[model samples]
Target: MKRQTHQLVLAILADLEVYLKTELDNVVIYDDGRGNEDVFFRITEKEHLPLVASLVKKYNGRLVTLTPNVIDDETHELVYHFDIEGLLINCTITVTDKKIPSITPILKSADWTEREMKDLFGVVPEGHPNPKRLILDESLAEGVFQEYIGLSDAMAGAATNKLWEHINEAKRKRD
Candidate 1:
């Protein structure tokens, strides 16, 4: 990350922070201190996601990736990684809601990412155009995070086998 790019990102983030505070409550920003990497901001209010997405779009950022992190038993952190002008901004929203508004309406790249989150976390992407399965099999249950309970022995064994087979296939293809 160039010094100029770093400063530019910081400035944009600072502006976003101020804006976020004014528009939404319980927003916290964390700087990883590793230059141009690993910055996180958490939005406590799920309703504010659309506004956050709008701000990211206004800054000409592209939604790079979205990840569902099982933070705790009742909470899942929906991390929306956005890249703007060579800077990565990770906006995380801790969700307990069964559904959250879709950002794909604003960021076209969110289409598949939102669906993937829904499939994996069972976090419904409300208003998503195509909220279909991404990588999960129809037979396997959703929200089956590795650490999650209620995972049956048979299902776990089947998944482990499928995973190994998929990994071996990729290795074979590469070879």
Candidate 2:
């Protein structure tokens, strides 16, 4: 049954490749060795995210989660995880300008996750219905986490001060 499900997912991805009129990059299938498999692939273009979401919906898949990771000062990666008929599929897209087309418009479940991503990573989800702060206060700067991650101790010293300033300001507002 697991083999059949994996084959079905591969076929669906193949169809997606055809629909996009190009081949997908970094495609990998990992079997957890415990009767479960995960399909991972790179979307290659930010504009194609909506199309990918639509295709996943067509296959009756539910968006499981969306995660944003900072690759460097200028690059961010968004990973969209989905579950289709009990199979896990992960699609990743690289964003260079800190903006990517939002999937919230297509999948309502993505609304909060997109907002959280915006607040944490400073990656604007273009076209998100409600792009307001979700997990971070407005007083805190967007992408606060991005600034601190992977920083040298010297650089972190500056970031730490800035973070404390924001925290102190937020605290004062409540008093």
Candidate 3:
């Protein structure tokens, strides 16, 4: 039943890759090895977004949601979640100059997704209409905040609070 649908999705993905000549692999399907059925896929980059979207349409799949995972001081990647009929799939794509492609063109829902990816991961989606900061404060300087401020959440919070305290103290002295 469920296994049949999962197999169908894998087949459709393989077929789509053939038609698009794109690198779409790292297909992962998880079901806890139990009664529940869950499926997922790990994509390559933005270049495959269109092909993925096309496959989704051709197979009656739906783009449910996407999230950009920024690996601070290392690598950044985007993870997309899709639901095909009754099967759920998750795909992760790393951002690279060679393969980085924009998904905004294929799905309007991807506009902000791309922007947020750029904002947090610094992966610029080539054709994003508004690739502005989605999570970061636009008023702050680029990378500087993340550099001198540090990357870890605990460290960043402490560092930021200390910096603000110093600024506030300096103002008090003047007044």
* Alpha-carbon RMSD of each model: 9.2, 5.4, 6.3
lDDT of 1 by residue, 87-135 (tens): 7778878787657899898888788888888777788888888777887
User: Quick one: RMSD of model 1?
Assistant: 9.2
**Over 4 Å off, model 2:** 1-3, 149-175
Question: Candidate 3's residue-wise lDDT over 5-26, tens digit each?
Answer: 5567668667867965866556
**TM-score, every prediction:** 0.70, 0.80, 0.63
Q: Please give the lDDT score at residue 146 for candidate 3.
A: 26
Query: Candidate 1: minimum summed lDDT over ten consecutive residues — where?
Result: 23-32
Best model number under lDDT: 2
Judged by whole-model lDDT over C-alpha atoms, candidate 1 comes out at 0.74
Candidates 1 and 3 compared by lDDT, better number: 1
Against the reference, the lDDT scores of all candidates come to 0.74, 0.83, 0.64
Which residue pairs in candidate 2 have backbone atoms (N, alpha carbon, C) closer than 3 angstroms, thus clashing? Answer: none
Model 2 C-alpha lDDT versus the unseen true structure: 0.83
Model 3 steric clash pairs? 40-90, 41-90, 41-91, 46-101
* Model 2 Cα shift for residue 174 (angstroms): 23
- C-alpha lDDT (0 to 100) for residue 83 of candidate 2: 82
By TM-score, is 2 or 3 better?
A: 2
